[model samples]
Target: MQWRNSSRNYGLTSILLHWGVALTVVGLFALGLWMRGLNYYSQWYRTAPDIHKSVGLILLAVMVLRLVWRWLSPPPAALPTHTPLVRLASTAGHLTLYAGLFVVMLSGYLISTADGRPISVFGWFEVPALVTGIPRQEDLAGDVHFYAAWALVILAALHALAAFKHHFIDRDDTLRRMFGRAKY
Candidate 1:
């Protein structure tokens, strides 16, 4: 597959970033949910958080790359079959997805460092705290991260449903566009 996008379809880089970010975000969410349920005696209570912080940092890196890629190579145009409203909504949705990803990661970082601890990424290196010494800052970050994450969940679901709608209901190549199978 081509590495760069064309007017007709998204290139491989976009597709990989799209699906890769999707998986990592979902996995991180699942891990966060599971860690919350752990009892004090559970080994994972300690280990899980370390893993979460490490992977979340890696995900932040990937998200940065994805954003840079998107800026350098915007995706192909929205499906020509879409109406004016659909086009506008599509643009908004895309922007929200990108912004949400950034906010979620940033908030996660804040929550991790709220207690004045450096984030150790798999012990290879440490990410210095973004914020420190603010009273109850972690608590505020926790709340923001929670709500923003839920919002991202809703938006991502809607995005997926719309893709399925176009593919199954509207009989279009919306999903395939990212795979570079769309005809010119």
Candidate 2:
């Protein structure tokens, strides 16, 4: 089904950004878990952490662009007959995801900066340090980053499950609106 806002379902740009961010977030999560499992002195562990930081900064930049795109092009219309509770839940869930993601990225950057490490953006560019001192800030930022990461995982899982429910049980076009209709 064509989405309500525009003549087409999700525009090509929207679909690309959505899938790109999804893949990046999932990869980051797995990398994070792997890095956490390694010993601090392990060279492999060091590499993973640096890669994670670099990829995360890239994700942050993409997310900013995604936000701008979203503002310029709102999501496809929701079901016309959603109950008030469902509407509230949807709004809360989306807001939580956006806020949590922003915080997670910011905390990661702060953590790296606090540790006196320059954040490399996808190995192409470096983000300048925000602060030079405060080791304790790094510890606190680490805690915040982990907490936000867990929250993001939970939120993303729920969002995906909800999409599946709409597609399979509700037999709605909600998922297809984002993914587009099958070519065949």
Candidate 3:
């Protein structure tokens, strides 16, 4: 595959980022849920937050790079089979996905630092509290994180369903395009 996207198909970078972020988000979601259920005595209870924060920072960085790459190398045109509304929805959906990534990551950061504590980056360095000493703000950030995460879950489900619809019902190349194997 080419290093950049073409009118026909996605490039290696896009495919890698798309799949990588999808997998990473899934893992993070499971880890977040699992860690939440842990008791104070559990080993991961102490480590999980740090792990989550570190990985989330990495994800935020990757997402930034992905956005840059996207701007540098535009995606293929909407499928011909797509109606005007479909095309609009596709555009809006993608924008929502990008926005959701930012929201989730930002809210996670806010929640971590909401307690007026610096975040240690996996024993490497520290990220000082961006929002400090406001319990109400912390609580609000926590709520945003929770609801935004679930919204992301719903959006992802709809995204997957739409991809499947294009493949199975619409018999289009929407899914295959992302795989960097679009014959059309």
Candidate topping lDDT: 3
Candidate 3 lDDT by residue in tens digits, 1-184: 7989999899999999999999998888888878889999998889998898898888998999999999999998888879999999989998998999899988888887877787788989887787666667777878888888888878988999999999999888899999998866
Q: Write the per-residue lDDT of candidate 1 for residues 7-103, one digit (tens) a residue.
A: 8888999999888889988988889889989999998989998998899889889988887897799888777788899889889998999899888
User: Can you give the lDDT of residue 90 in candidate 2?
Assistant: 84
Predictions in order: lDDT: 0.87, 0.81, 0.88
Off by over 4 Å in 3: 133-135
In TM-score terms, candidate 3 sits at 0.95
Candidate 1, position 101, lDDT: 82
The true-structure Cα RMSD of candidate 3 reads 1.3
Off by over 4 Å in 2: 1-8, 40-43, 132-135, 182-184
For model 2, give the 10-residue run with minimal summed lDDT: 1-10
Q: Which residue pairs does candidate 3 place in steric collision?
A: none
Q: For candidate 2, what is the TM-score?
A: 0.88
Residue ranges of candidate 1 with Cα displaced over 4 Å: none
Estimated TM-score per prediction?
0.94, 0.88, 0.95
Please give the lDDT score at residue 149 for candidate 1: 88
